[model samples]
Target: MSFIAIDRVSIQPNRRPLNDQKVAELMQSIKANGLLNPITLDQNFNLVAGLHRLTACKLLGLEQIEYRIIAYQDVDHARLAEIDENLIRNELEALERAELWLERDQILERIGLRAQSGENQYTKKGGESISPPPKTTVQLAQEAGYNKRTYQLGKQIAKNIDPEVKEVIKKTPIAKSHSTLLKIARAGSKEREQAEQAEQKAQEAKHQQKQEEMETQAKLAAEARTKLKEKQLIALQSSTAQKQAKQSIRSARTQVEKKINTTPILPGAELGDEWILGRHLIYCGDTAEDKFIGLLPSNAALAIATLSFEWNHDYLIDEAHIVAVLAREGHIQDFCARHRMPFRFEWVLGELYVGIYSQDPILKPEKPVGIEGVEGIVAYLISLYTKHDNFILTPSLGHAEVLIACERMGRICFAGDKATENVDRAIARWQKWTGQEAKKEKHCYT
Candidate 1:
């Protein structure tokens, strides 16, 4: 190699490190050793190699240094020689290598040397006077091992990025992943619209899931409430049945006691001497003096009592006897007065007395004169017995007896006089009084 004067050469301003400390050290070494290796240059005296050493000599203010001026016709071979030299030294940073590779491509293009296939150069063939430079900045970057995809994406990033953000990117080197992500962030309205659509779809899916969960929970709660209500109804029905059975047992016991206490008036006779005429008779003692009469029905008796009345062989005598008995009972007389009945013995013991004055006057008695339908009339009267204070009707008896009594009374007064209307009105009033229509219909009728 022949050495020439450094002042005769011009270094190409490319691929130089800007590190202050590294430049300072190289300047100190050049000042001491005086550039042991010469820089390489083209026939026009333009630098083709030794860029770092030339920079160090200039920084050190050296008056003279060594270099070699080669011809432009040999520049391609010279560039390849420079590249091989740098590779052996491993002296370039990634950015520096990128810049050097880019410069080599430009030189190849200027000389009309197209890179062979897979050679990564740009050039034009013969007969071309002048043409626009081949290889854009993006294509040059790709050949330098800068990712082509990234370079293509970077163009988009450069296009859409805010001026302020572009300034920041130019000043600061960001990691590749972050750079790509930022490019996406900087994309236009179309990209943003796509992102918004994705977000909305996700939100709708979440809302539908929540709504379905709520509906499922509501259905489960409703089912649980229905099961609880059914359990309560069953318990109530069981309690009612138990009460009815107890009342039945009590009524049977009362009837048995009455049968045992009754004394026969004739030999081998079943009829008693002092028989009380009423719906139910309960005997209180085992002896004559100890015996006290219980008039009217007990709750237990009323629950199961059926109405029945008959005229005996001594019907007139029985009528007379019951009349005498009512007269002797001061409370019975008072009951008649309270209910607004005339107190004369004729009025008490006449046709009216005979009418309701059999052995069991209030039972299924025969029709009296002027009472055309005696069964219906007596059914009406016995129904009134259930309404009286001393009746002692149980819950079941009260329910059935009151409903029947109301129906009978309403039928009698309003027969053929708007029967349906009267019945509906009476039923409505009765339901209001008892509060049992709905439950009764559901349980007993349905």
Candidate 2:
């Protein structure tokens, strides 16, 4: 151990950024107990280890500090020591750790000290160190508290990430994620290789006497490298955007499901009673029954019915201006043949059919309608058929899609379902949406 003047010690520009919190902690500890360990430095008082401790001592206004000197073969050898010291002791970010690991590996390889593959790093635990060399990659990984695969992956991240893309990544949340880094490093593999080859050719050209040609090759190489980096940036942005889109979809679905689950599903909405929800009406029985048909409004602009096993509701054509049945192709065909409704036209939406039926002649739409699943389909039909405060009729309240759509569009929904829970859910949905309670009529249609 030796003492060095605080002013004589020099820090390299490329050293890791000083951690202020760590420096503060060290200051408190050193002031309380004094520095138990000496900082490590090169012969010329260049810092090699204990950066936090050195900083603490400086802040404490210490004139000199205790340190140990290590004689290095050269600047590279000193860098290797510093990297090793940091890697072993500091809690580094993934990018920082990877950079240090790669630098250490390269320095060892350049100095002919890196151990070869299949070479024994240690014959036994606590054995003598290998002479004139370093440990194998597996051993190095183990020393770094990682498996061989993780160590190799870290090196790949350091070596493969484009510099500009790397700079962008450093400020983002994924910078600490090894898996994300690996994915980014793997993208644009072909472009990266091409850029590297171009750069190598340019370097080779520099050895010759053709100055103009060398400059041209160098410019081409630079352009290839730029394109390669741009490709990585685009790839990362696209991946991040896709991930966010999926998350948004998931979040939306989750919210819808949550509402459905939390809503009341009470039974016993009596078979022949009617309830009013603002301007909407809900019946409490099966639509196929004869008594239910008599109660139907004749002035309905459209009736939206879902396909069911009991198929006698075809008489809806006479009651409503237009009727649309949502069913599969086979079911629609079976219904058209079985019951003989108006069947004006059939519209295909993916595997589902919108069987349009009307007593009057119908005109085909000029353009195809965009689909946004079943709920959106119901909403679209409501929009096409009704004016604000006009009535819409649906036989089954299965998901209350029609009811909810009508409520939002300011159209009245005249809807019913036999299932007691279905009536309860519909009522609850309306109540939740409008922030008002529904009214059950005392009159029975029996």
Candidate 3:
């Protein structure tokens, strides 16, 4: 066809596939070889075809390109012609062919145009009755000389995905496999849910693994602490054992040293109760030296008495023995009082038989009497003569001389010689020798 200037035509807004890189390539080709053919347009000056070529020429900054103007009535026929020409000679890219086929089908549907019928689906009645063939997606791709697989996928995506998603797919540079998978995911709710569950499970497993690792670390730390404590305890026990052994050795050494250094004294012959002299002999002397001599007479008398009794009696009277007997008798009254026994002349004799011993010596006082008599003698003797004082006499000596004599001789005779003639006679001789009566005057006898 003859060519015309591009200024007389307008580009149609129908979708075109001119990307920046494609436009740049086309511009390079145009700069090298120039436009091989012009674009076509309708009377309204809308480009009915050759959109990509116009875009390529514009991007190359060309002031003009060749084109042909046709009336609106001829545009439809021109579009068919243009599609046929590209299918035969141009060999469009798979995606471009798919887009062209889809657009042609939509335009023909809108214009009430039918695809060419198949060979014998219906016979003509009365010269002309034609039925259009049902065009499948595969048949359309085959006619367009496009990949059946690519065309099928594109048709499925166009039908299934929302217009918004399709727009995104068209604009975005996503991989073909990923886009296919996304389309499948959009088509099936089960697939989408399953993918979400797999992602959730992966996260859960990671969290559980982290927790298990933390627990293992904690267990190891606790085990380490226990081992350390046991070691410390063992060390402490060893130290304690060492210290105890040292103390035991020291104690044993001390005891052995003490036993080696110690010495004991031998016992004396006079162990217990060995006495020196009697109270009567002691009273006969005025001093310690005089008392040693005065004891000689009593010792001689005891010796003589001992010799006399030895032939007939089992008991013996030795000087040391007589001294002990006298010392024992000296504590008789106090011994009787301490033992809670009645303190009488007979009690004094009983105390003499069993040795004079007491836990305590401070005896309780006697009951009060109308006129103190026998008890007065005891009081006066205890007050005037005790072991602490120089005048010390046995209970037997005092009781035998006073109370025994009074009991035996009768109270009146013991008081005065006038009560008995015999006593009086002895008294007269005693008085003549002393030149005084041996009677106590104004005696407070009870």
Q: State TM-scores per candidate.
A: 0.28, 0.52, 0.33
Model 2 per-residue lDDT tens digits across residues 11-116:
9998887878999999999999999889998877789998889999999999999999998869898998899899878578788788888988888878666776
TM-score of 2: 0.52
Where does the lowest 10-residue lDDT sum fall in candidate 2? Answer: 256-265
Error of 2 at 444 (Å): 49
Candidate maximizing lDDT:
2
Candidate 2 segments exceeding 4 Å error: 1-3, 31-33, 59-63, 115-135, 238-446
Compose the digit string of candidate 1's lDDT tens values, residues 341-397: 212222132222222232332222112223212222223333323333323211111
Ranking by TM-score, best first?
2, 3, 1
**Which candidate's TM-score is highest?**
2
Assess candidate 1 and give its lDDT: 0.38
Better of 2 and 3 by lDDT: 2
Candidate 2 vs candidate 3: the TM-score winner is 2
Q: What is the alpha-carbon lDDT of model 3 when measured against the actual structure?
A: 0.38
**Model 1: what TM-score?**
0.28
Error of 3 at 88 (Å): 6.3
Model 1 stretches astray by more than 4 angstroms? 1-3, 13-17, 31-36, 74-446
